[model samples]
Target: MKFTTAIATAILASAAMAAPERGLASRVKARAAAARGSRPLEAAQKPADTTNKTNVQYSSNWSGAVLENPPSASATYTAVTGTFTVPEPTGSGSGSSSASAWVGIDGDTYSDAILQTGVDFTVTDGEASFDAWYEWLPDYAYDFSGIDIAAGDEIVAIVESYSSSSGIAIIENKSNGQKVSKKLSAPDSSSHLGGINAEWIVEDFEENGSLVDLVDFGTVTFTGAEAKAANGESVGVSGATVIDIAQGSQVVTDVTIDGDSEVTVRYV
Candidate 1:
């Protein structure tokens, strides 16, 4: 979602009023950069069987697990939730290195839209920062103010869609007992939710129309991962497709699903 000058100015002004301690420009930058939701796997990348028991896929921008509805299936996902400890990002080179962990519905098999919420971890010049935010694709992510998030905080991310055009994104800082939420709607008809996929993902999000440098986010394990179908049946990560991030020919992430309700992503 490209932000116009007016929109950017409005966001900055509100952010300044909401979070005066964090600089206005940095908050706007983080929110704008966080809007790039999960993208389809690059054509060159394909699903492959790993030496382990699970099937693995490769994507340029995403790592974790995605549960997809079969083409012939009647049930659709309406809610997705996951809990994880925020990983402390370590900066390597210059500039800034960043990563985000989020739980969402759609954007895999149904690529038109995504309803997601998570925490972004970044390290710039050896100083680390964390922000909790929510997004509906085709619009810029909005940072959640009034909540203090830190590395090692346990976070619960959730997205629930009541219809194709409406949903809610919620973030709970379990370690601090603070919560924030937003009622989301499709920005346009093209971005409506289809309820085709539910995911727990660590993403190298986009900024200025390009992907930012991925940081070393140690390892993030999403526990209590669950998705509820429109039929009211709940499911976990078992039988979900595993995805690892690959930059060119070099794979940078290792993803594994443990039992039914846990999925882990490790920076490699």
Candidate 2:
């Protein structure tokens, strides 16, 4: 009934996405704004009201861009570089009328945009909150993809953990020049006897509560990653950089934004 758990919701979202309805972005943005205290009208809405739609509107500072090697354009769902896919879950909660359970549902993955730590991407402020769904794709899952993010003038590394999930997933502090890892928690709850596909993964975040601050790779003592930005020898964690292939290193540090931790780029 309560889809506040990550594992419970991933099962429903794991399935492939169908064609996106036109003007869905605007609707999502409007809904997100309303949820974040920006209220919108709902009672006046009509049943046959499928007319014009608007683009998602956000405050100027809320905008962002990502660098990605995207999938075929024709595909309904595009797994941009920073974005990952989730396989449909087998177990869900769809029972009889007398014994029914319902969970929240949301389906929005990261888009193609180059983002880094401390860049006001994941958590714009030291304290921010949102109600939504997310997934966690660590290094082991993406082959160490989306690693070495920066906040501003730091090595882009931090340590954080999840509250509860059937399994464990955490990022650690630094060790040597590499970002060493330690015990981290994750939310892997799958509810409804794991037999539905319309539940949601819910998230709640608070500032400085089990939070870990991270620095960019250059600022860290032992990061093998080096930045190749035109402005500086190293791009700060917050600065934007492209996903270069000629950088001589195919081994990217493990980064996790699959929705486990509140922070985006954690050190593990």
lDDT of 1 at 8: 98
By summed lDDT, which 10 consecutive residues of candidate 1 come out lowest?
41-50
- What TM-score would you give candidate 2 relative to the actual structure? 0.19
Q: Tell me the deviation in Å of residue 175 in model 2.
A: 12
Superposed model 1: Cα runs more than 4 Å off: 1-25, 29-54, 70-73
What's the residue-level lDDT of 26 in candidate 1? Answer: 72
Cα distance off (Å), candidate 2, residue 54? 15
- What TM value does model 1 have? 0.85
> Model 2 over residues 1-268: C-alpha lDDT tens digits?
6666787677656642542222224324533343211111011221132222232211111111111111222211111111111111121232100000001111122211111111112322221211112123211111112233222222222211122121121222122132322332222233101101111111111122221122112111212222222222222222221111111222112221222211132112
Q: Scored by Cα lDDT, where does model 1 land?
A: 0.84
Q: lDDT (0-100) at residue 229 of candidate 1?
A: 88
Residue-pair clashes per candidate: 0, 38
Candidate 1 clashes between residue pairs 3 or more apart in a chain or in different chains: none
